[model samples]
Target: MQRTPNWSLQQLPDMDMGQFRQWQALLEERTGVCVSDQRKTFLQTSLCARMREQQMDDYQTYYDYVTQGPLGAIEWSALIERLTVRETSFMRHRASFDCVARYLHERLSQPGRQTPLQLWSVGCASGEEAYSLAIVVEQALIDTGSSKRDYGIWATDISLQALEQGRAAHYPTGRLGGLTQAERNTWLTDTPDGRHAVLPSLRERVCFSRMNILELAQAPLRDLDIIFCQNLLIYFRRWRRRDLLNLLAKRLAPGGMLVVGLGEIVDWNNPLLERVPDDRVQAYVRRDSSESLE
Candidate 1:
């Protein structure tokens, strides 16, 4: 009987400059994530981890295997989950959420607002951001006396693994520190396993889906009232970042809001988007049709 190799003890081969470039090109082409020289070790470790599981010893051979047919496509999907960064937490950026809360208050205050709010949480990892948004929106509705207003949140990410976690809506108690006692009592329930689960009512309002940011043009979402796309654009090249922002801007409803990470992109101006002029947050509002005409 042939014994299986002990991958845990085996040393992974060092990824040479040429091999790194090939993998880099492939990642950029497939996902628009540009791996820099400083991140070579990060890329190597991520690739070697997957390679070891397949019992593949050579980088070039593994690269070829990942670029071929149906199997390659499936392998690529697994590989991307390892490569992409999914670090996130509830209310990670308080200022950004505060900005969103203010926007919701103003919008909900407007009379004769009959349509349900449509919000998107782009690159929402493990549902924290999406759930946090729900908390803010729910509070805003109640505070503004619009508790009967309808709304829905679309949470999307490229990693199906992350999306699965989002749908599960269960998080360790440590991750719930950001929630105030009142908020926690209102929105979360304790699980027997010591984790906190999102209450059913809030969970029902969030829809999780897998989406590759590179295929934004093919996305069916349009006329969105608010889009939270934070901590996601830093992976792409500068030009690609601009292109992604432009696509997001086009999807916003007139007078809608788009909030991005502070200092993620500079000198990126869109004719249809006007900066919100709040130094505390990096946000923009879509110019109303009549305002654009003027």
Candidate 2:
């Protein structure tokens, strides 16, 4: 739409007719995501590089080549990698941590098995959400005489490259402004300037990897107790949303919990989930999940 000649490898210009629609359909079919009309130009701009790399003139050909050609899998991976946004920051939506802490407090107070608390941060961008959850877990550790239950954190994203950035746990100083000086002292290694490195022990607490919600059906998440699939549904269409909700519901453990972003209301009424309160922080609990912060 902008008709800019110069573009990045990810930006595609002079879009071929039906090209956007073709890719849109493929995205929907493959990922259950729909590229809104307003965002179409953005996708085009983002995909120019793939076009250039593949030596293609327009999107239709690119889509065909990317989907059905021998190198289709690689191109498709790149397509999904570039199109899906992964912007995130430390302590994104502070309220979520309070909710997690509250849930853990109430759950652990009761008679429960002493296994590592399993938590998932789906669509976790740059690993901040997982680390933020680690902060909560570290705070929630009981000071009892001999309590040493492990805490497990899995941070997953669609972008393999982004996962690399997250696994490194390296962040610029300015982006860490949200941490108090004292908090930084505890959670990070202070550098000469404001920059800090997340403590290696804390970094070791998280496992970052690549995953696809589209592949949720075949993926195994049988033992997960809490899932944070935040701000991820906005990319998808309705039928796809319903399909994903079904998979999300099925993947959750009987008493596990699902914590989506605040105000995300795609399939809230799905029979598999029930609305619950963690003090004032609202989230969905699996219908049979008995875990609660009372």
Give the alpha carbon lDDT tens digit for every residue of 1-294 in model 1.
Answer: 122355578655778899999999999999999999999989988987888788787888888888999998999999999999577888888899999999999999998998999999999978899999999999999999885849999999999999999899999977775678899899999999998999888999999999999999989998889999999999999999999999999999999999999999999999899999899899999988713221
What lDDT is reached at residue 119 by model 1?
97
In Å, residue 150's CA in model 1 sits off its true spot by 0.5
**TM-score of candidate 1 on Cα atoms, chains taken together:** 0.94
lDDT of each: 0.90, 0.71
Return the lDDT, model 1, position 122. Answer: 94
For model 2 the local lDDT of residue 272 reads: 70
Shift of residue 168 alpha carbon in model 2, Å: 0.8
CA lDDT, candidate 2, residue 227 = 82
Mind giving the per-residue lDDT tens digits that candidate 2 earns over 13-113?
55554777777777788776688777777777677755656556566666667777667888788777777766777777767767766767765665756
Top model number, lDDT: 1
TM-score on alpha carbons, each prediction: 0.94, 0.84
Give the Cα error of residue 74 in candidate 1, in Å: 0.9
